[model samples]
Target: MRVGLTGGIASGKSTVSAILRDLGAVVVDADLIAREVVERGTPGLAAVVEAFGDQVLTPEGDLDRAALGAVVFADPDARRRLESIVHPLVHQRGAELEAAAPAGALVVHDIPLLAEGDRAGSFDEVVVVDVPTEVQVERMVRDRGWTREEAEARIAAQAGREERLAIATRVLDNTGTPEELRRAVEELHAELAARP
Candidate 1:
């Protein structure tokens, strides 16, 4: 099964992805791929520089994510422009990884923007890690050390909670303890693995 796993920032999606990985799922992580594609010397980085200019690059010739984030998150047009350059590359790379997975492997694509990108239907199952927006904000503030405003801004940049839930084939409620979340994921794994 090809599973698309997604959730808002700090919604415990990464935790769920890690558990799925431990349980033998072939996980293609889009966030990791996004960073790799934009690393210095790649065509991805070159395109970004050409679009956003050198202000978006670091002194070491790396993509200055914070600087770019500050620009894109605040401007919808800028965000869309960045997406136009990056999304196609990410989708292509993700497809390549998915194709390399062994036959019958439960391939999970951990894409943060699955819903935002309208790509949920591309997967066999879309598993949304659901959490309230407030919980997400609190988690971001406490764990990531981001200010509430920053957390809110990042959240606003993605699809709304309702929008994500609407696309979910299965919703993993993550408003509970870690143990509870783990148990839920294990159950989900068993269920998916049982599919023939």
Candidate 2:
């Protein structure tokens, strides 16, 4: 099964992903693929430098993600440009990983932006880790060391909660304890594995 797991920033999606990993799902992480595609010597990095200029790279020639983030997150056109360069490469690598998974393996694509509509139809099932926006902001501030305002901005930049939920095949509410979340995931795993 090809599953897409997504949630807002700091929505504990990683925790669910880890649990799924432990349960033997072959997890293909989009974020890691994205970084790999744009690493120092890749074509993706070269394209980024061309589009965004050398200012987006560090002295050692690695992509300075923070510099790029500041540029994209503040300008919609710039963000689209950056996506134009990176998304195709990310998707390509993700496909390679998915193709290599064992037959009948549960391959989960942990995509933070799966609900952004660009990746529609990319999965057999879509599982959203649902949490309130305020909770997301609080968790981002507490866990990621972002200020509340910064957290809010990041949240606003992504697909809204309702938008994500509307397309979900399953919604895992994470407002409660960690144990509760784990239980929900375990149940979900059983349900998914039972599908022919």
User: Against the true structure, whose TM-score is highest?
Assistant: 1
- Alpha-carbon lDDT, every model: 0.95, 0.91
Model 1, span 1-196: residue lDDT tens: 9999999989999999999999999999999999999999999999999999999999999999999999999999999999999999999999999999999999999999998887888888999999999999999999999999999999999999999999999999999999999999999999998896
C-alpha positional error of residue 126 in candidate 2 after TM-score superposition, expressed in Å = 0.4
lDDT of 1: 0.95
Clashes (N, CA, C under 3 Å) per candidate = 0, 0
> What's the C-alpha lDDT at position 100 in model 1?
98
C-alpha lDDT (0 to 100) for residue 105 of candidate 1 = 94
- Compute the lDDT of residue 126 as modeled in candidate 2: 95
Model 1 TM-score is 0.98
Angstrom error of the Cα, residue 14, model 2: value is: 1.2
Q: How do the residues 88-178 of candidate 2 rate in per-residue lDDT, one tens digit apiece?
A: 8988899999999999999999999888855747678999999999999988888889998889888888999999998798899999999
The numbered model that scores best in lDDT is 1
